[model samples]
Target chain A: MKRILLPLLIVVVPVAATVLWAWWPRTTPPERVSDLYRRYEHNPHLTVAYIEDFPVNDTLTVDVTTIRALDAAGWDTLAKDFRIEPLPDILQKKLNEGKDLVTTFLAPKVNPALSMDTTDLLKNNVVGISQLIHTVSVFSIETESQINAVVNYNLKL
Target chain B: MERKKLKGKELEALLSVAAAEPDGLPGDVAAQATATGMAGFDAWGRRRQRNDLRRRCLAAAVVSLLLCSFASVTAPEAARTSMVVNNGTPRAQVIEGVRQILEHKL
Candidate 1:
């Protein structure tokens, strides 16, 4: 019995470990986000971006081209299904006055303690959001922002 | 047949003849004994070699099978994420929803 069990154990343990390592679901936000980006990076129609900023700055701009593309791509349903916070009062007032708002999305304040390093922000959260947005909607708007630079720099040369 | 008992002199003569013979068995008997012994060794050696080959082949097969299984399981990470993303929201519906938001807001 001992002889039989020893050989069986030697064969079974490594196979089981390899299987678990390969199939285990990724739980971290960073892992999920990176995976999402890799899956969609090959699509020519989609573009992904990431941005990092020091201090909490509440500013977002969405260009007309992007808006039009979102409209054409049929993103209204995604926005409705997902929880999209209303535009800030200032932006709302501008909208009421018929002023074009440039910012497209703004994230709420994050605690400094919870704030990840700039590298982590780019690798995980930023790319994750970009992929999430693209998955929900299709947009052709190109914004001249730091995110564009960061994303382009990260792209394969 | 009637049993015949040898006289003391006859018995002495037979013993002397046996003692005078060489220590080793006759040539034909020795050759036969050596051949039988070697035959047993050769058979055992062949069986051992076959068993070793069989064990090695089984090990290689097990390792290959394990590697293939691991590779197959890991190769679908992207596909797995995509499945999770699109679980409830169909791609077409998401796209349509985005388009509506653009039209209404812009």
Candidate 2:
């Protein structure tokens, strides 16, 4: 009984399962797609703003002209707030070209302290500004000067 | 099969004969008949046992098939996806053409 029964079960079980899986009606649900959105980030020198598309989060529908105008307005506010306009000509050129964008690091320039620690500042924003403390500290920006501004404008295009 | 039993005068005659010869062929004939009958019965018993074993094996195989199906079945998972869209802006030429069309109407 044991000899015949063991071999019969081994062969039959897999064959029966494969047949059942093939005949089983598919009850798979429809696929749901998430919304797409836009975001931009500033470079180390604060000259060029790199923009790219990513999945999830808030969706933004913006034209190139609209982006250019918004960037110029942001540059003007940046000049007034930080009291230092090192890359004005370069940023203005990029903004005028209809292709590029501009952003600031040491940005959202909250307090006017001459020297401040960059341990946990500028972490929560549209851009990943947490990495800019080292990059923006170069050139003549030894200490982030006192600049009072809520420059984080959520310009909905 | 039927056998005539010795009774009355027949039984007396057979008893007398058996008395004449104490060791006779009659006893040996009876013992041989019993042995043949037992051999036939034994053969039949062995055949029935084989049939019973075959039935048990078939029943076990059927039960194993049912259990295999139970083990194979499982709950299905849901399908989902994430998508990225470029939605590129209008080309410079296309925008210029649209602008030209609007300007002519103005």
Candidate 3:
């Protein structure tokens, strides 16, 4: 009985600690797309954007130009916000054309101090235009920059 | 019978008359009836008919292509967007607002 109890405690403690470590929240990340729109309202500069349900049979294409522009900006951090599970034929063309789109989810806060690569890429470019598409449903939506870094690029050296 | 190939100058004269004549038959009156009506005229007629058909088909293809392009440019923007908020914050507050708007419509 003693032997069994000691072994159980040894296994349980480590398992619990591992679980806690895995589950523990590190820092409060930025908001997601939906949150940004809600917090900012429909300010145009910020919004929750997505391409709507696209049909499997219909050949009509629904392109979210916003994602391409955003991809150019480098805000496509999370896989949930950038992946298109099974992309449509036409949308795939745009994606191939260096269009930045995300089907994955990511915290929406832009860390100015972090990296400026995305911002530099999007310099002089527009932002906050969300696509609501419905040509094919196999595709996904991507998040655009709420406050365009291009605007900053225009101002700063 | 041996075939007589017309010279460039003769072909030019023949072509000029053919264009002006409308029927595209040779200018020589003696050859009119016996030149197979117009030297492979059946073949020419078939060619013209095929060309007309091809032109019409090409025009139709162009129109359909234009219409599809227009439709692609004009489709309504649609999405199945939902918001999931965590904890009590503006994010949650806004998601609630959006849900309310959606629910009201439904």
Candidate with best lDDT: 1
TM-score of chain B of 1: 0.39
Which candidate has the top score in TM-score?
A: 1
User: Compared with the true structure, what per-residue lDDT tens digits does model 1 show for residues A30-86?
Assistant: 343333234434434433221112111125332111111133233443234234345
* Model 3 agreement with the true structure over B1-106: per-residue lDDT tens digits: 3334454455456555666775545436326434544455434555665675566655555655555555444433221222222322233333232222222221
Candidate 3 per-residue lDDT over residues A1-157, each given as its tens digit:
4434444455455545544444332322234332322432333322233322222122332211122112322233212243324468786787577553322122113421222334443222122212222111112222233222212222333
The whole-model lDDT of each prediction reads: 0.37, 0.32, 0.34
DockQ of 1: 0.05
Worst 10 residues of 2 chain B by lDDT: B76-85
lDDT of 2 by residue, B1-106 (tens): 3433433454445445445653562764334334444344344545655676567667766666766555454322111111111233233322232222212211
In order of the candidates, what TM-score does chain B achieve? 0.39, 0.36, 0.41
DockQ category of candidate 2: incorrect
Cα displacement (Å) at residue A150, model 2: 45
In angstroms and one decimal each, the interface RMSD of every candidate reads 11.1, 19.7, 24.7
**Over 4 Å off, model 3:** A1-157, B1-33, B37-39, B79-106
Which stretch of 10 consecutive residues in model 2 chain A shows the poorest summed lDDT?
A130-139
Better of 1 and 2 by lDDT: 1
Recovery fraction of native interface contacts for candidate 2: 0.00
Separate DockQ for every predicted complex: 0.05, 0.02, 0.01
